[model samples]
Target: MIWCFLTPVLGAVVAEQYLGRVKTILYSAAIYGGGLAILVLSSLPAVQETVISLPGLLLSLFLIGVGTGGIKANVSPLLAEQCTSPGQVIRLLKSGETVIIDRELTVQRVFATYFLFINAGCLAALASVEIEQSYGFSAAFAIPMTVFIIGFIALMTSKDQYNSSAPDGSIIPSVLHALGITIKHKGNLNCTRPALEPVESRYQEYPWTNSFIDDLQTALSASKVFLLYPFYWAAFSQLLTNFISQAATMQTHGIPNDILPYMNPITTLFLLPLLDRLIFPTVRNLGYPVHHFPRITAGFMVCALAMLYAAFFQRTIYVSPPCYDHPRSPTCMHGQVPNDVSVLLQVPAYILVASSECLASVAGLEYAYANAPKSMRSLIMALYLSTVSVGTFLAMAVLPLTVDPKITWMYIVLAMAVFGAGAALWSVPVQRKEAG
Candidate 1:
């Protein structure tokens, strides 16, 4: 998993220094397709019987991870670049009210749409579990392999539609060269001060432009904002790990245990359209600015509320009949077969987390791109994505509480931790004057 997150930094470097976004995406997609094919073949009964090996499985995963990281880093910025508008615009509504169509907000909407389709793909992938149970793992793997191949072909068809940039040839070395110039001019100690302006002689001696220095400042500020993201992601990561464990201790009635996980995406699919078309526009028309930080802060609180609900749900699961003190007991193990409370009860938590995604997840993507220098979009976005991995690592601090009755306390602690992180994030200064 760390490898999955780490590879994007390399992808960002390659994209910015060697290949532009379009070529990088195409090349990565091909690599990804090849790796998926290898995975599909490896999972086959015939291959398993003949010569399945852990090394082969690991190699496929590594290849896929690298390719995926490349795609994840570049694609959002590429899609966002499609919107030519760089600032907010005012339009007269049919209701005789004025509405501000904000570029940052528009980028947020684009990312929301992007995630909506991404979740749609997830919904389809969840369906593959049915295939895995009946037709076998080979067939299940084939489904995603086929889907990725089709997506690659579709991307190829639209190649001419995208805006592309040439690689600037190794950005880090250039940054180092500029930094050396600054250090020589300003002295090493004063270079770290926020108020220190770049010495004019340094710009003349080095190729560093005023715009580059200013943009670097913006990029650094954005990176600091990204540092706060891991808390929200750490809280969100529970849906993928611990929340699934929580679902296993509840009654599913006739539903498959795996189906409950789909609720997050399903709720996201429903809520995104409502937020984009109605709520946001209405709020803007009412003379409120839906700034990224405030929206993200709200998202953090919403996620904290979701965790609060999960804490209560876990408490209920602990006290409920069949499971009683031991949710992992022999009878309680199947969850579908023997459990006290209905799984339907987990719906509120899923819906609340989904709401947070609309606010927090989309806001993070927009904030990364909108705040970054055009040259640093993929790199900055990769840094933002890296927060999830960081948050996951941070979550290890609470690993001891992942079991049984202790899980309730775990959710409560995470709720407070995430909420506190959100408050801290809200206090961090943003470069709005620089942004303007």
Candidate 2:
């Protein structure tokens, strides 16, 4: 998971400098397909006992991580780049009335749709779970491998239809040189602006313009906004790891423990259209605009609430039945049985997390793309994605506390941490600046 998040930093640079977006995605997909194939083969019953199995599985995971990183860094930027319209336009309708179209809203909708399909794809996890339960791991892995191949083939056949940007020859050196000049001038960014520099000065050594400096500043501001995201993601990450363990300690009633996590994607799928078609429009018409900062702040609060509920729910599990504080106690048939609490009760937490993703995650994507310099869009997106790596590391640091008695406290701490992050994000001066 860390690799999945971290490799994107380098992957974005590669996409921008060497392979334009389309080719990067194609190469990444090929590598990902290869990894999935190896994963399928290694999971087969015949191969599981062989010496090659573990190494193959490890290598496959690494390739999958690298491939996912490349795809993640480029796909959203590429999707948004497909819209060629101006930011705002005045047009005449069929009824001879004039109307103004806001491309920012269009981009927001595009991202919402993009995020919707992402969750829709995640619904395949539900299918995988069922397959794993019914047909074993080999068949389960094979399904996605096959689907990936189909998707790759489709993309390859239609590659010429997409709009792609050419590599903007490396900008890192110019950025570094500009920053060096800024520092030399006592932290004045304007010192590097082309109009302000002397003819023979080092600033003139580069070809960057005043607008590039402004864009660089804007990108830096966006990065500051992203600082809070790691805390948000750290709390959200529990859904993938600790939440499954929580389910195992509850009464599943013949349901698979892993199945509950699908509620997240299900909730996202249900809510995305609702937000796009109804809620956002209704709210805007009612004279309240939900901008990125507010939306993300709301998401943070909602995630905190989810964690708070999980904490109480964990407490409820501890106090519940044949084995208080330890659902898997030896007294209860040596950990063979769970407590009386129903695992289905976890659905609400999943719903809240999904709601948070709708707000924070989608808004983050739009915000990053909207604010990023044209040449640095993928790089900024990768920086935004690296927050997930930070969040995962945070989760790992607290992982030892995920044990029986300490689990409830862990949730409580996470709730506090996320709420603090939201408060900090809301209080940031940029939020008020954006509002103004």
Candidate number of the best TM-score: 2
1-436: candidate 2 lDDT, tens digit per residue: 8899998877788788888889889999898999999999999999998999999999999999989989999999998898877868999999999997777788888899999988999887778877998999999999989989999999999988888788776577777788888888898888888778755684445588788898888877778888889999999999989999999899999987777888999999999899989999899889998688888888999999999999989999999987779888777779988888998889899999999999999988888888788888999999999999999888776787898889999998899999999999866554122310
lDDT of candidate 1 over 1-436, digit per residue (tens):
7677777777788788889888888988888888888888888777787656555677789899999889888999999988777698888999999987767666777888998998888788776898999999889989889888888999999988898667778565665665675577663533523445456543444444556777777787778888888888888888888877777777877786667879988998899899888988798779887778877899999999999999998888888887675775765555434457888998899899999988898888888888888888888889988888899998888899987668888999889988998899867876742211
- The residue ranges of model 1 lying beyond 4 angstroms of the native Cα positions read 86-102, 176-204, 330-339, 433-436
Residue pairs clashing, model 2: none
What local lDDT does model 1 show for residue 143? 89
Off by over 4 Å in 2: 90-100, 179-188, 194-204, 331-333, 431-436
How does candidate 1 fare on TM-score?
0.89
- The models' CA-based lDDT, in order, is 0.81, 0.87
- Poorest 10 consecutive residues of model 2 by lDDT? 427-436
